[model samples]
Each structure stands twice: as structure tokens, then as C-alpha cells.
Target: MAESEEELKNLLMKVKEESAKYGLKRNIKKTKIMATGPITSWQIEGDEMEAVRDFTFLGSMITADGDSSHEIKRRLLLGRRAMTCLDSILRSRDVTLPTKVCIVKAMAFPVVMYGSESWTIKKADRRRIYAFELWCWRRLLRIPWTARRSNASILKEISPECSLEGQIVKLRLQYFGHLMRREDSLEKTLMLGKMEGTRRRGRQRTRWLDSVFWVTSMSLTKLREVVEDRGAWRALVHGVTKSRTRLTTIFTIFKEDMSHILSIYLSANAFQHSVVPVQLVTHKQGFRVTLIEQEHEWGGTSACMEEHGLGIWDAHQNAYAVHRNTAWRDRSLTSWMCSCMPTPLVPPASAMCTEDWCGSP
Candidate 1:
């Protein structure tokens, strides 16, 4: 609160005098000082106060540089410790997956996200946070690192409505809105005010508001206007969080599924003679698989299935039967159509297929 050492000394002397009148004493040994630029030695009543680069206050780390990276790392460590403490419950077969997820959300997530509302998250920090979240889920599922399971698979198994980052966004938006609504306060002043200073050179570091603006895709003026209406602000925050979660889910699915399909196509020695065009159609329910057969020098018939249908190979009939359900039964050549077939045929991969191509039970 003081601008200089002289001002701080005067302020400390006045505080000591006021405390003495109330029969109290300030502990100089416990007192610490941190400056934004450089550390300075300080002595109060012949006792030297400690100078530190960072310190914990109210369960949150306060650094001299005003960066939240250290605090985030600390939180991740705490989260890991919490997971370790609950390893028994998480690993128990008797404990349901839902119960384990609830426990993680209630216990582990809170520990990591304790004071995240004030975080000025960068791309690297966000990545670290998401990785930590995945780690927590993997541990809960008792999945070892050697398993090589995709993050999408894990997310699909758990089916979380919102990601940890999304939750942080929600908290940050709520806090920002709260601060904006206040008429006059120190927090509001500090958040909205800017100090008069010169440039520090090099690329500018991401600020807290900058992260907010990036997430919300709104300018300060427009954000302020929206914040005036509590309902609108809440809706905006919800939309942003929901969109982020949806996009993340979609991207993960696309990445993993595409890679899987490509690996299958490339590894198949049968498809070297023909050109197979695979198309991915996305719908609200899920993803639809489409295979288009193109004629080549060998001469073949073009086969295209209807929209929202999967082309499954019928090994018995040597034809393809279109399955309406998008759920993939397995990743085998017997289930999926062979690209080398001159006459492509799609069939259902399910065991309970009523169609004749699947054969009578």
C-alpha cells in the first residue's frame, strides 16, 4: 500500500502506535515484503522483516511479478496429492464410476481450482490444466500410462458435461460480472484501472482481462453493457462455457476417429488398387460414416450410401448393407467394407442383425 520505503516506515510506525493503544502488537518476524521489480531490505523497530519473491495469502499464492503460474502448479500438486489420498476409493471395484467422478469433482477439482478465478491463463497454462484433468481421470479409472488410451475415449467413458477449463471460465466470468456490478470497491478499481507507465519492451504478457476478453470474444465496452443485465451476462457465460466444452468434445472425437480410420485404410493391403473416398458427416446425435466408391483403371461400379448410414461389410453375402445406427461394433475388416471390392456392399456389424445378410439366429 506504500509507494516507498519511507512511506512504508511511516505507515508501519502509525500502525504500531494504533495497535499499542488497543493492547496489541504486530509480529515483525512474521511480516514479509515483496516488490514487483526488486527486493529491498527493511527493518522495523530494530527487527529486519523478511523479503520474499512470493508468499501464500488466504490460500492463494501472491508473486512479486503478479503471475499465477506458480499458484497453478501448486494447485496441480495439491490435486495430485488429493488423488493419491483417495487412491483406495478410486481403485475399489465396489465404488461406481459415477461415485468416483463425483468424488473427484468434489474433492480433487476443488483443490486444483481453489483460487483460479484470478488466474491469467495462457495457452501453455491451459494445456497444463487440461493435462492435469486428464491425469486425474486416468488415475480414477486405474488406467496406466502404458494403456495408450486416447483422451477422447476417457472423456466419452466419463461423459462430463463440462471440462475443468470450462468450469474455470464459468468462475472467472461470474467473478468478473460481480466486480463489474459493484458501484465502488478496491477490487473493482484495481481490475478496471491502469497504471501510467512506459513500455517494458519485448512481447507483452497476457493480462487477466485479456484472457477474459479472448474467452468471451467481447470488448470491455460491450462486456460492461452486457454485465449491466445480470440475466444476459449469465446466459453469455453459460453459452461460452457450453460452446467450449462442445468444441473440445467434437475436436477430440474428430482427431481420434479420423486417425483410426486413416490407419485402417492405409494398413489395408487390399485397397492399393482402388481409390476409396471416406467422408465424415457430423450430426447432432453423433457422427455418420460414409464411403464413396470411385471407379478406377480396373473398372468398378460406384456405390454411395444414404446419409447417416454406416457401410458395413457382409462377409456371408459378399455385399454391403447400410446400417442406420452410428454406433461402431468393432474395428475389424469383417465388420467394415473392403475398398478393393469391385461391387461394394455395406452390412450391419451388430450381433442381433435381423437382416438376412447377417444370417438368421
Candidate 2:
């Protein structure tokens, strides 16, 4: 956002430090910066003549992957490391700036499309393609100086013990992998269906189907901001509605799963060691459902008593009187799992139907 050379240098230095921590080195000679122009850019060196370029400083996409050597893999890993750093820095800002990194063209590692290629044939070499794509759209859209200031302020709000590097690594493994998995599954499924009548019948192969829900890696606060913001929320709802027909079948599948999940229990300690009862038995005979909390933090609201409990009316616990007494009750949970134990059963409003939350006794 800010075009200052010093600011850019400092940010790049931070990225370089992160790369070295990951046992990867950055080659600055391949690095280039376009401070002012039709398009701003940041380029960093890669292994075997590979280089990563952030198009217009909006995003960094991987390039130069023709070599199948270990060195090339190391460079790709560095590219990912750089991306993780950028994401953390961007999230620290209150106002997100959108960024897009386009990998110009390069050799792709066979590992990306693992298990799909036939072992009978020799691997192709030197194809011009983007190995990976990284989008930092939120960071690009923000005002630079404001973004930096907000980031600085956010550091004070967070714990010094909470390592940003650790966070980046976790986010990369958790969310980015999920996103890629979903995208790859969808692409493969479409391609597989079309291969029946296509010329490349031999290339047809099995791929996993996309799951119904993929958790957003963004923090709860960020998620709440996006989902609650009128503009962003409206757009999301509208888009979902437009795709409702395609998702209808998926929704039915989800409802089936929801009906099967009967109980929920969550607990956490000072060290954040947590336990969540995944599956809860229902009151009905032979019916048991699993509970999946979309929310990351499932601790109760009480600051003094950190321990919390939740249960649905199930065959095992329903007969117990202790399950019947609880401060909060979700009437809609009559059909599924709930926070309270057995209660005066009634169908509550759809929104009121408890899914997952934490609160005091």
C-alpha cells in the first residue's frame, strides 16, 4: 500500500528472515521492485533460476519449476513460506488490502498432482505452467500506511508468546491445504465426468469429491467481520442463493448428517489442552450422531470457571437427572444435539437451534 522504499525494504527483510528460519535462502539478485508504474511488483530469487514475483505487489505466484531436483522443491517451499508471512502481516491490519500473485509460467513438480499420473510413462519436462497461486487480495486493497499502523497496534493486542511464525505455519497446513483440496477435487471431478466421451480416455482417473463444508482459516474475529458486514455478507448470501440449486443436493446430504449428530461436549484448560465429544448418542434407540464444531474456540464464557459441558437428549444420558438441569437450553435441539440435557422439548427458531457455542452455567 505504501510506496516508500524503506517500508518495502523492512517488509522484505522480515520475509527473508522467515525464509531462513525455514531453512530456505532468498536470492536478492533475482529480486526486483517496481515502486511506481502501471503495475507494482516484488520479485525474489528461487532455486535453479526460479524466481517468485508478486504482480503489482498484490500477490506472489511461484515461477521456475522445470528442474525436478531437491533444490527446486526447496525453493517452492520458500515460496510457500513467503506467502505465509505475507498472510500474517496482512491479517494484522484492520483494513485488508486485496492482493493477487500470478505465477507467470514455470516447470511444475509432479508432487502437486500426486498419484494422478500414470507410472507407465516418463514424466514430461519444461512445461510452462504456474506451480501454485497465492492470493493476498485483502492486503492489496488496504491503504498501506493505515495497514502498517493497524498491524503495529494489533501486535500489542496479541500475546508476545504467540509466535507469528507458528501461526503462519499452522494456517498454511490447516486452511490453505483445505482450500486446495476442495479446488482440486472439484476440478478433477469435472474432468473425470467429461473424459467418458473425450479423446484422452486413458488420462481419466479417480479423484476425491469435494466436502460439504470447508472451514475458513481466517480468525473468528475476521470471520465475524466478514459475515456480519452488510456489504460482504449480502454479497456472500446473494452468491450462495444463486448457486443454491447446485448446493441443494449438498444441503440435503448435510441435513442427513445433522440429524445423526445427537450430543456435544467441550472442555479446555489453562494450557488450552481441549477435548470435544465428537459423537453424541440420541434418545432414540439405534440413533447416534457426531458433533462438529465449526467454531475454533469452543470454551465456555465464564472467566472464573474455565470448565464447560454440553449434552443433548440421548439414550445414555437422557435418563440421568443431572442432564436435565442446565442454564441454557436450545429447544431446536429436540431433533439433534444441544447444550443442555433433557428439557421441555419444543422446536425453536432455526437460528436459535444450537449448533456450537460456549457459555456459563
RMSD of each: 14.5, 21.3
Q: TM-score for every candidate vs. truth?
A: 0.69, 0.20
| Per-prediction tally of clashes | 6, 20
In candidate 1, stretches whose alpha carbon ends up further than 4 angstroms from where it belongs are: 246-361
Off by over 4 Å in 2: 1-54, 58-273, 276-280, 283-286, 290-308, 311-361
Encode model 2's per-residue lDDT on 244-287: one tens digit a residue.
11000000012234554332322110122223544332333333
Model 1 worst lDDT run, 10 consecutive residues: 263-272
Name the weakest run of 10 consecutive residues (lDDT summed) in model 2. Answer: 244-253
Candidate 1 per-residue lDDT over residues 1-361, each given as its tens digit: 7888889889889988999999999987788888765667668778998789999999999998898999999999999999999998998999999999999999999999898999998777877888898899899888999998877678778877678888898999999999999999999999989989896989998889997887776899999899999998988887667544411211112232554332121211011122245434332233333443322221121221222222343433323334433323334434443333333223324323353332111
Clashing pairs for model 1 are: 312-347, 319-345, 320-345, 320-346, 321-346, 321-347
Candidate 1: lDDT of 297? 24
